[model samples]
Target chain A: MAGVRILVGTAKGGFILRGDERREHFTVEGPLFGGWEVFHLAASPVDPERLYASQAGGWFGQIVQRSDDGGRSWNPVDNAFVYDGEVGDHLFYDGTPQPWTFQKVWHLAPSLTDADVVYAGVEDAALFRSDDAGASWGELTGLRQHPSGTQWQPGAGGLCLHTIVQDPTDPGRLTVAISAAGVFVTEDGGASFDPANRGLQSGEIPSEQAEVGHCVHKLAQHPSRPQTLFMQKHWDVMRSDDGGGQWTEISGDLPTDFGFAIDVHAHEPETVYVVPILSDSEHYPPDGALRVYRSRTGGGEWEPLTRGLPQEHCYVNVLRDAMAVDTMDECGVYVGTTGGTVFASRDGGDNWEAVVDHLPRILSVEVQTLP
Target chain B: MIRVTLPAHLRTLARTGREVVVEAAGDPPTIRTVLDALEGAYPVLRGTIRDHTTRQRRAFVRFYACGEDLSQLPPDTPLPDEVVTGREPFAVVGAMAGG
Candidate 1:
């Protein structure tokens, strides 16, 4: 059958497991948009029946759901983002000087070839574009009017713009990852942007090579080598080859590189993936073991994918868009946990299974490979 | 008509059945003309109960009626005559602070 949907995004709703293509049986369906929070779930490489969700809540805000007969039905569209004129300011993790605020849609990048073109990564960090498929949305504003955006600061998950990386062979390049603001590059398609965070360092700021407060915690590339990027920084495990403009500290032997997702293996452009997490206030998994550190040769030789997961008590924690990969043909690796389990490995991670476990608390994991 | 109730997640995204009668004809009947007439007869409940360019109101939403708390009144105020007729329904609630 060669089908596979996966798409999950949780913390109350949105799930659709479905499976085939030897990834072995699965058929979960959904919490649909129930209770709200769906953070990100995109599918439209040129229209796989078109789908895009970022439904949110805290009492109904940020809604954008489009599915033209794919998720079986959905419409919502247009949740007004407004910001083009006076919405500029950032730096308040006590650095004071606040202002720009709109708080929700944490990620949803659609348009690798336009299913009506999309892209919205909000939460005060800014960047929105909806070429009319999700009804309407504007504001690209040279990425918060770049110029190092008043030294952007606010991570602890507030200043968001969470990972957008799309360079399917440069349709005017793109790479966005902001959380404490770091790594921004839009070679003239997103109107304007710079700070690719040259060789990021950030020893808690005050110029450790500052350009835009480094807190980038995820940025994988590989649509056939989009200039080779791959990061999982909030604490090293980076590598760039001139796309995010110079970075290199592949975090070699990795046991504690502190992480929040980083991926890049669809057919091995040197293969890569990360799930380190043990430091940065210990967010679980180094000794509580749930390993998944592959790297065929992309970032410093790694290897841990631990059989069907869980080694001794398995503490969980695997977020930052919650990892995903599936172009099928024997390469399938999907992960989503904060203890709501989703792990599946068709063959890439070497072996693992569990497509749907608890359900609410995943946040994101996309994949649509139907045929 | 104007009865409105929704909020079990917008009655499951307007698939309906948490009470809804709608038809907020304005002239003095406010709460943004009854949510612009319940999102103009459920146009996907427009930005989910207010906000699609600062029409404001969604901070864990709240809007009651004959029981007042009209979500802090003033979306042009004036609502009560049994929620402006249809004998008080106008709900929309869902607040319970963070986590």
Candidate 2:
């Protein structure tokens, strides 16, 4: 029990990898929901044994599976993500408003305090809550009904609410980021929300400072300093200091800022991690060199960490939700590549090694720190 | 009694024999009645074959009986006599891929 277990969700199934605190040796468990598309996998904060996954079938729609005993066994829970009241429409790719429809669950963020309560971010852009231990889901329609809803358009990945970050200091405070839509923050729980995309720019859009419609790929925040945030935009790396009130570009010195996946170090608040893709259209590393860039000065300056990683002839891309950090003293960093490899670093980001390689394409990766 | 054949995934989910017999409950045996009985008997299959709220067949699912595509027919439409009489299992199938 004094080690680390990683929860990995992939295109083919869900897998659990276990290792010692050093993270050198490991055991790979499963392809749990084989043949299903597992979009996101996460473990409940209070109870590491409790886990939840966002899975969907080609024909059966989305299903939420829960495991009370870590990843040993799984049971399909209430995956009925019915929107509150009559769901309206959001702007489509063509700019023609289309009816809002439930597509799939994109992300699941379990509550830090209550194992029974978890937040789900979904596609077609909405947030849902399941307080009954993933037995049922009810949409928090207030976020979707924001005045900026009409202006939100789909990114290449569709308009999906992919990032869910809860403030550690205030239990009621929550923040979510949607692709092509931007960021929204709720101070009084999910009853209401406000667009938090001030000082952001999108090259595709005509506005230099639009309130919404920014394609935020991934976002991560340190628990001790929740107000300060880091983001990997569709084209740039940005940081927000005032709880997303405003953001400034911090893509300095990286080969390219366009990438997915951003995470804060477990122990170092100023340290952050991101994998730089060549560009949105290319979806590969710069010059086929897979590097994990770390920003120790909180984003203005950066350095690349690549020891055991593929520095040559690697063209895999890390998805937005594929990177995670473990709360160990040395602080471990992990990222899942689209090519089906999970790379891990135990001594911060100085060096990395693959825990498990050659499975299905990875969609997300999460870690559990055990006592 | 009615005989029903489920798609592979649904069969695995329902945890039943490939061909199952349902009582059709207290109603005349129709496609809807048999489906309702199947769902009631296997709770795990709820919303798998049809929309949970609308009860419409999933876009990729189809119904066939007596070698005819009964998918376009309304849910309330009476299934063919062979299916209701258990002479043939009402085939619930995954629509052939790519039309």
Candidate 3:
């Protein structure tokens, strides 16, 4: 009885898509938290039953909720999930005001090996590490206080850490991507970080890009190959070997380099996929065409997989977490759009089908394979 | 009058079988009145559709009248004739999804 659960968060609230893998019949659980924007959705890798979500509003502060029974019911943590120090008071300096109040938790990832080790990325481009699940969180003082933290400009949403990639092979070796901070890696967990965007073009051109501080939209690490990485940068989809120490552009035949979500095959390192859209002024799909392109050889060549989708005039903007690859036997590929549509590709982006439409502005898509 | 079909979740709450008949003169009228009448008859469905105090539709729950999204349509907006004539049932569905 394998159940595939999709955690969908939007500006209003969140819901759960419960589908039996064998039957393919699906049902949604609840609106969950009403009137709150759920941006980050995560399930504990160690315990599939435990689910976590980060909620925020235009004015309300950020909060994290957890579900013990496969997201059927949820409750907020006893103490609010946040950094150790207060929002606007720094003990080091005489009241310098510690930037923002951790506005949004864009990415929530539990440690692949440690059940209690969970990491959260938030506004002001801060990284918080929790060793005891959501019970207590401490700021990664090293990364938060790095000299480069000051220049890490956020994307349209403000400076925030949107993606966190932990090495399954080496639990201590981890990489995180900030919108404008490019990519940073820590060999000894979250103790310290160094800019790993050596060969990456920071921005549009080689000379113009920051080299290390490029505006990185998202990052995808092959589940098996810890050294190989794929990123949707401000300009292109890039590839990096040797654990993000350097990068090279791989967006050869794609319609445009601008996109949000990039997913690497869980078991196959060479196979990766990304949803492309027009960059700069042409921010939607190419000529208003909505298609997900797959590169069999690590973003070398691209092929548009649009079967069972709109052929013409599909101007959709897929968010960073909206497109995900199911790590199952069928290797399902799913992508949700800002237009409130979710498409599923069971054959790993070879074909596509619209499973649900007109729900709301889909902010994030997460696939959790049940045991 | 438009015939309304409640999903299993709502049907269990409404204690009805297949379809629930709502009385309306013209095209099912608007989502507001349809919900008002539905809840008026089945008080349990009142809080489920809209908040008890504000009477606002619950987030992620929308109305579908004749294959059209009636989520943003004002409560007073009139429904289609097919829905009013019982040819089509106005569905108050909870948008099922999670990510």
**Best-performing candidate as measured by TM-score:** 2
Question: Candidate 3's residue-wise lDDT over A1-371, tens digit each?
Answer: 48688888877778788778742667876576666788878888898888888876543245677778878777655224345444432221222334544456888898888777788887767788788778766778666666666545556766778889999898888798887667889888878888888767653434554644577889998777889989998788899888887789999988888888899876677888888888755667887778888888888798898787777888778889887777788788888888877788777877777767776788899888776
Which consecutive 10 residues in model 2 chain B have the weakest lDDT in total?
A: B22-31
**Per-residue C-alpha lDDT of model 2 across residues A1-371, encoded as one tens digit per residue:** 78899999999889999988677788999888787889988999999899998888767777788999988888888767777877778899999988777788999999988889999999889999989899878889889988788778888988999999999988889999999999999998898999998878888898868888899998999999999999999988999999999899999999999999999999889998999999879999998999999999999798998898998999999999999999988999999999999999988989889899997999999999888
Per-residue CA lDDT of model 1 for A1-371, tens digit only, reads 46888888888878888897776898898888877889888888887878888888868777788998778888788888888887767779988888887878889888897678788889888889888887988988898988778668878878988988888877667889889888888888889988888888979887898778888888888888788888898898989888988898887998988889878778988889899999888788888988889989988889888998888987779888988998888789898987888998988898997877988889789888888
Tell me the TM-score of model 1.
0.38
In terms of docking quality, model 1 is acceptable
| Clash total of candidate 2 | 0
Best by DockQ: 2
Candidate 1, residue A60: the lDDT equals 75
lDDT values, one for every candidate: 0.84, 0.88, 0.75
On a 0 to 1 DockQ scale, where is model 2?
Answer: 0.58
DockQ of each: 0.30, 0.58, 0.02
Better of 2 and 3 by DockQ: 2
Pairwise TM-score winner, candidates 1 and 3: 3
